[model samples]
Target: MVFWVPILSYAAVILLTAVAVLRAPAPRPPHLAANALLRYLNLFPVGLMGLWGALGHIVFPARSAAAIGWATSPFQTEVGAANLGIGLAGVVAAFYPNWGFRAGVAVVTAGFLGGAAITHVVEIAETGNLAAGNAGPILYTDVLTPLLLLILLALTYRSARGPAA
Candidate 1:
């Protein structure tokens, strides 16, 4: 149950984001400009998180330790970057209701999902272990983060499309 809770939560977030995005409006020049600026700034943190994750995997060589250590490493940095990107995109979308915001969300979400998937697969192949009996950070970073991002994207989209605020 504990293991599944995060998974379910992530799924819910994704569903919500998808609905929101679909309801959003077309891109506007002003919104696009703002989102573009935010996107550029957000990339820095996201890159850091990714780097941390990669480094953790490389240095620790232990799934659980690698996952936990990632918090202080490049992985966390990347996650922070992505969080900023998504968050800014959400805010911009709410204000602008445009395609640029939606696209930003999509791009960042994809990065999270893509990286997590790749890492999980590689870990499984090399270590022949999946979460190593659920005492590892791998599940949180590799599975939970992507799942939540997907949900957040969906919600952001929905909010963008909903009645303008």
Candidate 2:
């Protein structure tokens, strides 16, 4: 139960975002009505998760520091920048449903996931433990979350654009 809670919660966020994005009322209007509502409802939770993960990295230094290589370490700085960029992308995607917005989300999502994957590899090399205790949470937040978001983004893009484009 303890280990499963975060996984379930993250899944719920992704599921809800997918539902909202798929069901969004036709994107027609002054761009300030239902579209705004849909965007916020879909993207806000994911953004908050990213923001929370970033804050956790700072506030729970003992736990998160090792995963990123310490708060001030170069690796940590890169992770922080990636997280911030992804968080902002989520916010922007909430308000814009264009191809550009989708591309930004995809790019940020890849950056975040790639950074986490690299960090995990580095940790494994340094410590000889794949499941470094402190690293699990970071993997859940950075790797799993972005992967889920990327899937959601792809689904949304496919549904919105159809098969041709």
Candidate 3:
């Protein structure tokens, strides 16, 4: 039950990361190829994360909520919808990858993940939720992935700076 969430989350992250790494754009030329890699790395995994967070809860509201030890309620539905929206934003940003779109997605995702991490910590402190879905290894991702996203965003800016900066 609880274990499923961690397994699913890790699997999703790994699968998406692999896609980002392996299916990197090969649209000719060396430097453009680098930008392609950067774009894919920035977009796909985070989009997948958004999707993973979104799909189950929105569609299977009860089971999704129960998996995280929450009541099957409207709150879960709302959260699921939010996730779906964020995920769709990620998808749009992935395709666009302009400064405005990419930066917006990155910032929104970071804020969301930060909030999630805080909730996990608060849950641990207030109610002792140690479920794999809640306080398991996946919890670290709620903290780490956002930071990595910011770094990836920075890489975009760095690459934009033409390597001297």
Candidate 4:
């Protein structure tokens, strides 16, 4: 369940956003799909997922550690704090929707998740830790979510710029 939360959250958000965007009225403004997707991604996967992670790591440290195939430690609290910060940033980005603010949030989120992906990889290589949290959907999401956000960011930027000269 620990591993599934991130995966399911991401999937649910993406899928629902796609459906919503598709069903919206026609004569849509520029970048409607991209903008909607970016908003939903920030609000749900990045925002809520990070908060959930914080909750697990801080409020349920032992379970969080075991899921990751690690011993519980003081570091979990620190990690949880980081998660809270990033998660709040994501939520704010969703509401604000300014290009720079959203971009900054996306970049910061990418760094955090990218670092996590590396650590997961290292744990797998050096320690052979294949626990669900270490080797499951979370690992993939950590890598892909950032990539998707960046792609959407770029697309939105181009859309905002209008067609090339």
Ranking according to TM-score, highest score first: 4, 3, 2, 1
Runs of candidate 2 with Cα error greater than 4 angstroms are 1-9, 14-46, 58-63, 66-78, 130-137, 162-165
Q: Residue 57 lDDT in model 1?
A: 45
Clashes of 3: 0
**Stretch of 10 with least lDDT, candidate 4:** 156-165
lDDT of 2 by residue, 78-150 (tens): 5555556666767677667775576667566667566756767687778665443335554555565556545
The residue-by-residue lDDT of candidate 1 on 1-165, one tens digit each, is 324433444444445445544555766433333333333222322333444434434554355243432223445445455545555554454455354554665576567656766766666677664553233443454554445444544544534465573
- What residue pairs clash in candidate 2, if any at all? none
Highest-scoring model, lDDT: 4
RMSD of 3: 4.2
Q: Which window of 10 residues has the lowest lDDT sum in candidate 2?
A: 28-37
* Error at 57, model 4, angstroms: 1.1
Quantify all predictions' global Cα lDDT against the true fold. Answer: 0.46, 0.55, 0.67, 0.88
Compared with the true structure, model 1 gives a TM-score of: 0.39
Return the lDDT, model 4, position 133. Answer: 92
Q: Which residue runs does candidate 3 get wrong by more than 4 Å? A: 1-44, 161-165
**For residues 27-145, could you state the per-residue lDDT of candidate 3 as single tens digits?**
63344434454355344445666677777778887776666666788777777777887778877776785756777777887898789889988988999887676787557767776
Alpha carbon lDDT at 22, candidate 2: 69
